[model samples]
Target: MQNRITEQPSNYRDLEKKTIEELTKLINTEDKSVAPAVEKVLPRINALIEVIVAKITNGGRLFYVGAGSSGRLSVLDVIELPTTYGVAPDLFQVILAGGVDRLVEAREEMEDDKNEAWEKLEANGISKKDIVVGISASGTTPFVLAALARCRKENIDTGCIVSNPDSPIAAQAVYPVEVITGPEFITGSTRMKCATAHKMIFDMISTTTMVRLGRIIDNQMVNVKLINHKITDRATKMLMRLGNINDYDTAKELLFQNGSVQNALKSLNPDNYPA
Candidate 1:
């Protein structure tokens, strides 16, 4: 393979000879650079997020298409939206090249399946109302590239998050975010820094979209799912604090009765909430 920055040798050589502490510090230094790399692409990221928000608010959906580590990370990001922001499960979808069932199996060969992502998106009934964002560290994953190409040909809005510049995936994307994370500390282990950048960007996109979509009230996740004791307890506390319910048990009771922090708060005065 041709030399990309990701394929270059590590700056600190003889890694097997280094102590655990030395290795950790070296990796830490490299990891610190990831945030700045992402910062440089904030403008591009902002543009892509604007498009996503527009599409989703109009009853459209968002789809993340990728393979390998990128695909798995995208899957993780989308799965959290329903619980975290109370959006519909289908609002943020993911198309993993090998399917989510094989996500952890290290099925790297699936990245070479250029036709799979388009098929997956088509199966999902992707339309111009939906926006598909491709994720790839090298910006050359055939799975992602082909999907974006198909989306463009069909006039669907398309975007991409990649770690390299002037890559094929970016060329196919209408709004391409290229966060140059430089070389990986382990020289090709994109699961480290590249994944971090993608995670941060995903956080930005999903959180901002949710907040704009009215899932958040103030800084709290008022619409968050109360699926477990931990979250139930947290929501109860929020209800007590926001609704001025001095009694803890009463606040907890209200939470169970209403089912969500937003609902609990609105119950205090129906006039305060929209019809």
Candidate 2:
């Protein structure tokens, strides 16, 4: 068992007596502490990401599993990969303790069902070709722990994002990331600082992985989806800038014809296009 840093008592006292301004300032102060915590674990995060990139590049997929707030955050992370980076939707998947179909509802009791995650992964045909990341701020979610243990038994790659050190879930993770976010301002409410840490790392992983996979060009989201007028307009402008076209209509026409920023650019520069 580990010292559950996320479950520690709040450093502040008499919260109910504080003014709203004081409360906000205190919470903001605590929130500021989150980045330093995540900063200390960047090396571990980098190592895990390297493995993820290698596996995913070789046809492997990424899977995130967790419960409650962690589960919801995991859902948010992978769901946007397609629209944000133009990655294939099939490349990222999330298995929430509460069914993804029930994402709008808080089915906390489902977290106790230790077998559900494993069953879901099995049904998804999870194999050694996939990398499973368990997200549990307390580092003790039964759903995530059970799934990671089973993945290990089956020789599948396993990693974890946890806020506590030496936790059971972390023990099961071959590549464990312990961000040690101390304690939430609301005691055991991990949706605060812990959530912030996990969210930041999720962004890092997706962005870096997409870049390594050739989805990004320079510092731009050259693979973004133009699903709406705003994005279509933005992509048109980006194409004009990146492709060095003088006419907006020409850039917009090429962008619409090719579907995405990357493809649009490729159409204009076939000689320098990737495979």
Give the number of the best model, judged by lDDT: 2
Model 2: per-residue Cα lDDT over 1-275, one tens digit each: 64988889989888999999999999999999889988999999999999999999889998999887867987888889899888788798999998988988979899888999999999998999999999898889999999999999999999999989889999999999999888789888988989999999998888888888998887887888888888888888888888999999999989889888789777777878663
- Candidate 2 lands at a TM-score of 0.97
Q: Please provide, for model 1 over 212-239, each residue's C-alpha lDDT reduced to its tens digit, 9 standing for 90 to 100.
A: 7778887998888999988988899988
Residue pairs clashing in model 2 are none
Error of 2 at 241 (Å): 0.8
Pairs of residues clashing in candidate 1: none
- Quote the positional error of residue 167 for candidate 1 in Å: 0.5
Backbone clash total, candidate 2? 0
User: What does each candidate score in C-alpha RMSD?
Assistant: 1.8, 1.1
TM per candidate comes to 0.95, 0.97
Every candidate's lDDT = 0.87, 0.89
